[model samples]
Target: MPDWNRRSVLATGAALSTTGILAAVGSTVAEEDASTEGVATGDPPGWSSVHGNAANSRYLPLDDGFPEPNTIAWRSDTLYGVSNDGDIAVVDGRIYIVGEFESTDYEQTELRVASTDDGTLEWKTEVTGRQRPTVADGTVYVSGVDRVTAFDTEDGSLQWVREFDSEQWISNATAADGEIYVVTGGTRFNADATLYALDGEDGSIQWKRKQVEARQENRETADPAPVGFKSAPVAVANGSVYAITGGGEFKGSGSKPGLQWNGGVTALDAKTGEKQWGVVLEDGAFIKIIATDAFVCVQNMPDGLEETVLDSETGETVLTSNSTRAATADVRVTHDTFRPSSGPITVSTYGTDDSWTASDIYYFPPLIAGDTLIATRTSESSIVGFDLESGTEKWNWEFDGTPHALAGVDENTLYFKLYKADRPTELIALRASDDRGEGREGDDRDETEPDDDTEDGSDESDSDC
Candidate 1:
């Protein structure tokens, strides 16, 4: 049985929009006038998307100066209260983003938008859910509590909205050509993992592929099973969308042994939700793909876990390695019944702890800029970058606070936002270059310091709870 919320989809999106924290600089609103120019101000200076580009390259070109050591550019304060892990997009110069924050009044989540220029307000349409916004066809696409929506980028006007029967926890949206794709799932026991394609212009349903249940069983609780798509699907030039899903409850038993439920990649026809190919991965394997002329850099597990790269066309194994990183999931048991499991379960072969241990990470999707693949890794404490082509660790930049949001801008810069860290949540810039001359600063760009004349907009002044 599927858990469908009875609330109106519009109401849910409106609800999620108001909740969730989307911090930019984490600083309070200063007295000075903040710029709302965002990317419109000029060249995008930091991580533009979570994986950086549609290619999901956490990698950036190091020829010039990008992510160089410790260099902060313009650090603008973000919307006060909301929290955001939503990937960013740069269009028409403005940096459009949706973040969630705890509302002090009702202790609910709030979504807001800030400028990339000086971090000024650009009209934030409040909606619910943690799904990131996918900007395409001149419209902004996002998932709320129970639906996908498209908003006019020019005036933040509502273009069209489509509702779903289930709730979407932290999903991601992808778009190519004229179609918008969305994946929905959450921490609840519902594992209806399915993919949806909506018209890019009017938000009509192009197609919906009901995900098949995995042949695995629950290792812990026998009460209910977890299902649904947790990862965002990547759109390819081959006219298909790629993504992963957890197979839930084979034979009506939630848990399974061996590779039955670990996970796998499913390719769907873009025009019509047709299944192209599906591959079941090893017991603990996860897959990520990077497109290239030679081959798509299908990074297997980024952690010490092993991974096999398959040919994009035929889904044939091309490369295999156990040295990559894959995102870690917290499928542990908690005191509350609402928690995922009834006991401590291993989400990955890697040890199940919060540390940066090889097992506690998910290598961010690699960024493909020019001939380079920029890759990044994240945890509650640090954010690091690596070169996709050589698998060389270009740089490892640590964050004082845990970052819920991260994205790559170009070959030379990576952008990220930190919360509960030392300073106000910040949107810091790193120079990606190799010409660090010893004592010389790795990044020549001046750090983004608050202007003296601006108002004292501190993080404390943030919205509500």
Candidate 2:
């Protein structure tokens, strides 16, 4: 298993200059009827946020089936100087992007919006630091090194800006209901971690919760010890904020070893900054959290990956699996390799225990679209989709350049980008096929399918890459 670090896990995508493109393309903002306070505007019927929606399920329910091979609908013109890590956020017809653009004289980060039909540059705003943009209620929210700003979705005008007093780094904003939730932490070692809830309309601070505190008992001899939020971003569901907080001391000349780290999930009321329940994950670091209708799945890395599913109402453990990283209501992706360069990736169904029925080897995380599990081949510019139930290869597609990120997917299209260091980034949109064939039957399969095979054991299969 490869060791995962904070930087690699939260690394964002980059963008290129639209200096001339913005001038050539002309657009008008669509006027939407105003809704009551605390009510968020609806995202278009597709993949809106990075995690699909506010619950961070990363599951897209498309009735029109998944994308098939060799179904290219259109490809946007290459955008030069865009980083390989930059991502796109789609709302209605608007596509929001954040990335660093480099020119001969200088380099700067930018927030841009483009049209979904033609990928035309609508507007661009210069920003500091790079973080993925979040859109809701006709507004775009962006976070920087020490502040969070909101811009009008229509005109690219600054609506509100909220700054922090201390040197703090803010994570991506999760907007839901009528509030925006963000996790923040101190820049210095052992600094405190905080979660802030701001108004969606005016950016006013409604409530703030301190999750962890900084501590330095032996400042002179021991390394600075800090504790704070360690997860990538916070997940909100059932009127609650789901996040993790933990910290450990760096091993120094005189610091006490093995006594510095602990973490767990802490649930708080979304309306007020009050604690509901907390579970301590002793000797484990909380890596990710995904909230769904049935459970709140948490990824804890003590040695390898350990996924725990807890009841949404009561934080009780309902199911547990080893090496499981991604999950939907029916299927899970698990493997022993931490940074798998070329190894088996298990596709399993779980009820109380996991049943590894299918396998593949991929460098990036697999995405579940409807009943199919899609993944990119390890060290190759190809992607394959597999049926979750029958373990059959449904479709495969090869790209001209190395695929960088799976931007998103909607009912009729799958969006992704290709990378070539000397060339501009190529954004491609593929038409999703409506013919699901036999795989559509797996969607209604029982959660507790037969597990006659060995429990928690993976099937050895040859790589088809």
Candidate 3:
């Protein structure tokens, strides 16, 4: 196995999810009952943003949906992939996606709104963005190369555009509690990075935090390697902001050129930008992290490494392991679900010392929704759900189109990108059951079709959907 790092992961356009290390082998496909229970009807849960929420935990706290969906809800017509920045954002009864359609020249960028109740196109707006769109407080925020643009949910109209100068590059923008937290930095080594909190109503910086650490080195021995937050993504939850801070380049025996080392997770006060606590790695750097209100999970190095779970409030090791290896974090939350190539799904949680390893071909991101673990495999076009604790196979829903990425989950529906070879991709929704009888009563919203306005939300691109 190769030593994995951030640069290698980014180059592949995929992430080796932080779940436990594994070797997949035997394959099983069974039609199991995906019965769902306990739905709060007045309002169904929505994926709303990346990794389920601002915390980026990937853990959607919904009791109504079955993680192992056994039926298809609806599928969108062939949709082309544009310069995608993030996954689909589910809000209210509508889903917002960034893509292109019927564009042979690839110049126009479109943001389409559709009903999750059934895949109905509600409205389309010309928008500029790359990462996953974030819907918050009636607005959809999209971050691109030069600026961060906002669009209204009601009619997909232009809300605002926050542009930056040439020296500073916008990394990512996450919204929470009426404020959008953004990170901007220079790509060069040892460059300064800044985090800005912006107002949700308009593109205005509320507060900015710039924390820079100088390179520390021995004049006669090692090179100066500056380390800080750089351009890493953050998790915001419960009045706290968490980021994996590291920097520069290392020349260890088999070290890669563009990868950073000596990095770990750091927690800061969300409201004040004050540093709270941090756990820096001394041996190997962190691969990924997931932050929840209860715990923060970190996935570290060496290809076959396990998981590490830490208490969110304190920078303390709370994981109890019976194995010879240390614990891991972040695997339980949302991840860029990837195929492990070969490995049995080895899963363990922090709550109990007992663990289980289930035989499966590929283990994508371990998204724990209620009691079901929503997993995907690359062997065949299939989505499988496993019993979160017992590792029991729930259901394997296969499709002819290739499944790209797991966007988000809402109520009983799982939204993802599916593409056919040489043809444009499609937006697919999978459900736990075939009948709407499992859905909460009144889960459907009052339908309204707004006159979509192209070029309405675009800043530097042509509007065509």
Show where candidate 1 strays beyond 4 Å: 1-49, 59-71, 79-86, 102-111, 168-170, 185-191, 211-237, 246-260, 284-304, 323-368, 371-406, 410-413, 418-421, 430-465
Regarding lDDT, does 2 or 3 come out ahead?
2
Question: Total backbone clashes of model 1?
Answer: 101
Over 223-338, each residue of candidate 3 has an lDDT whose tens digit, in order, gives 43334664545777656677656553432121334543455556665554555555544322343456665576665443323334557766455552211111223234222222
Q: All predictions: root-mean-square deviation over Cα? A: 14.2, 15.1, 13.8
Tens digit of per-residue lDDT, candidate 1, span 1-465: 112222211100000011112222212212211221111011122333344334343333335544344444444455323344436665444556656543343213334444444345555655554455566656766666566666666656566656666544435566666666666554313335556655567655555555532223223334422334534445343454656554533322112232222454555455544454454444333334443212233433323234444444444454554322222111110111111112111212212233222222323222334333333344334444433323355556654555545553644444555456445765654444323211222332444432323332223323221
TM-score of each: 0.57, 0.70, 0.70
**Model 2's lDDT to the true fold?**
0.56
Ten-residue segment with the worst summed lDDT in candidate 1? 9-18
